[model samples]
Target: MTTAALGPNRTSRLAARRGRQRRWHRNRQPIGLLYVAPFAVLFAMFLVWPTIYGFYLSFTDRNLAGASAPSFVGLANYLEAFADQVVWRSMGNTVWFTVLTTIPLVILPLVVALLVNLNLRGQWFWRLAIFMPFLLASTVVSQIFTWLFNPDLGLINAALGSIGMTGPAWLQDPKTAMTAVVIATVWWTIGFNFLLFLAALQNIPAQIYEAASVDGASAWRQVFLITLPLIRRTVLLVVALQVLASIKVFDQIYQMTGGGPANSTRAILMYVYDTGFSNYRLGYASAISYIFFVIVVVLSLVQVRFFSRKADR
Candidate 1:
């Protein structure tokens, strides 16, 4: 074609392209926002806005039963939390519970996963049985354990009597209440860690064990020198997860013991709930929850670091 004809054709093409680009530029953000709008609204409504408002509420006298409007109280609630003996006791109970439960929750699951990973005769049954409790509702588990731990007419005490031993009041006694809650939490939640460990175990190459066997490494030796080292990261990941979950314990404990006999099993979360709803002190409850939130953030950072270091290794 002649230069004049080609020039007109190119001009028309460039104009069309520019028009399309302009249309796209006008539509991109809106289209993207439209796709994201549902999740954004839900997240803000349930998580972000509540977190922001709860922080604001922490600095006010926002009593649920108060007839007057909430007034700003500055740091008074926080100051009171620091001085409150029940706060410290509940916090201590939470820490103690975390300590007790984290050990078995992490260790027992790995051990069970290891045993199950041994290719037992009834693999499906073992796996399902080990994991079934985790699927139970917290309320249901609480009820089951409550009955099991009953001082009278319960199988646990009945078995104890058969063994010529008397069982303590698991849910009623201050001494054993937290212990009972810990046992329930372990039975209810250990399956998750077991699954994690089992997955990591399965991912391990069989040749590594074969190589270890060829080298005359005993079964226990292979576990110690090969399997464990390879799954070290998984173990740490489980520990971190268990720690965080144990710290937030409330539901089963609440349903089983009601934070009794003398509030021995009361977690920090229970304290926060009782403060907010039961006592109608919303401001104090918010402050305690925010404090707990900060502690959790710090703990999460530490756990991430612990998990990251081994993974990087």
Candidate 2:
């Protein structure tokens, strides 16, 4: 007993030694960095360096063609972008598209997920049907929709004719071009949001609904009070993600409309591409892109503040 009091037992010493070893292992900073160095180098080489260089390019006249040497132009490109009516118009179109798509995309997914979560008939089939389009490549979806919206022989117009109604020249008219793009985007992207909402719904306990039912709560009431509150975070997440995605939309619109019909469907990103590659003014494109980037950063900050307040409440 005296010996035990004077020194820790051998087993206790061994455990204490193991604890120290674990702490030492965890604190091996250089070794941990060595393990991560390859990915770090690749990320820096591909993403970080390019982002930094592009920002630098925004201040200079960097021609894509080798016709002229790059010269520092300071804020000249930014000033030009600020005064350009087309840039403002494209920004407006982007916001309009975001507004048109965000509401339906968020609401439809939630509704579909709620119904599917009730164990409806053909559960797996419903899930697959809802999510299959998201698995298709953007280029394929855009091409299919392009053909579907064709003025002459498209199925949509034929279906309209069967109802004795005239279909507008969907893609050929400037008035309808943006609307067509919005429709295509919603159909292509809604599946991802559906899965997010479905996962959230599944996480909700079944007992809550049962208790509400026993207490005389109707289906609509349960949805309004219980389900919505439970899935509020998921809804916000979907909205934020959808807004960002819509803002950055390029691929489908590029392939389908080509920002045509008088550039009515031109997005800011499309403008950037046109400026950089088509016009061969890489510096001006970089400047316009940076302006759009600043706007995005502001929106993100606002969302963060809003979500933080919501969480606190």
Candidate 3:
């Protein structure tokens, strides 16, 4: 009788333990979910909602004028943009600027980073000086350069004349306006890329270079065979950044040229601004913006694949 009574009591105790364990698990689940809730809400509110709304706006004939409802126009905006000569011309100029700027922006910075990495005096000073321009506001840099590029009384013109070379009308001439913008962008932003390269260069172990020297490798040979190969990831990162930045160049162009001199320096961003604000064709501008966004996305994916393959090798 005693043994049978104790068996029932022991079984009841085991059941109670399992019940408590289940309740504990249930309580912890909600806490975990609570931690993720804030980020999820913000991501949905800011990123997801705006993206969907923008896509919807692209199909409608919306404007900022009156409080009238948008008329659904389907693919009309895209068709109009495709047929427009100015749209195509602006796209060409944007691509040209991106290509021209990306090269110098990637190359010059890497070279400067390498030189700065050498055993030289005042390393901090050199780094600070190079990076100072990046801290300036885009508008400030653009305004300063605008004054410098003035044909009549600009410092740049004066310097060129002193060297016995005639300077072109940088902002007035359609031919050289885009080039001037590219030059300004490079000087203003190359510092960021240089700092990135410098950091990557420093991360590389000094012992590796010392070993290369011990094996009688010349500086150029060591750079090609070891240094370049080691910092392949940083190079790709710098290139990708420059490409994206060059594509979405708006502030500098807006402040410097205002897409003037016969639209020679006009970028796709300027085109979007003109369509949306100046012309009040919000739907058409949204379509162009989406198209450009898609292009950038695709290009970024391609570059990632290319760089990933190289890193793997």
Model 2 ranges with Cα > 4 A deviation: 1-22, 25-27
Error of 3 at 193 (Å): 0.6
Any runs in candidate 3 off by more than 4 Å, and if so which?
Answer: 1-27
User: Sorted on TM-score, highest at the top, how do the candidates line up?
Assistant: 2, 1, 3
Residue pairs clashing in model 1 are: none
What lDDT would candidate 3 get against the real structure?
Answer: 0.91
How well does model 1 score by local distance difference test?
0.91
Put down candidate 2 lDDT per residue, 1-313, tens digits, no spaces: 8887857677788899999999998886578888889999999999889788889999999998858789999999999999999999899989998999999999998999999988889989998888888989999999998888988799888899999988889988999988888888888888999999999999999999999999999999999999999999999999999999999989888898898878888899999999999999999999999999899999999999999899788
The TM-score, computed over Cα atoms with residue i paired to residue i, of candidate 3 is 0.88
Tens digits of per-residue lDDT, candidate 3, 1-313, equal: 9999999899999999999989999877777778889999999999999788889989999999858999999999889888988788888989999999999998999999999998689998998888899999999999999999999899999999999999999988999999999999998998999999999999999999999999999999988999898998999888888888888889999889899889898899999999999989889899998888888889888988988898888
Instruction: Say which candidate scores most in TM-score.
Output: 2
**Colliding pairs, model 2:** none
Candidate 1: residue 188 lDDT (0-100): 92
Model 2: residue 234 alpha-carbon error in angstroms: 0.4
Q: Is candidate 2 or candidate 3 better by TM-score?
A: 2
Which has the better TM-score: candidate 1, or candidate 3?
1
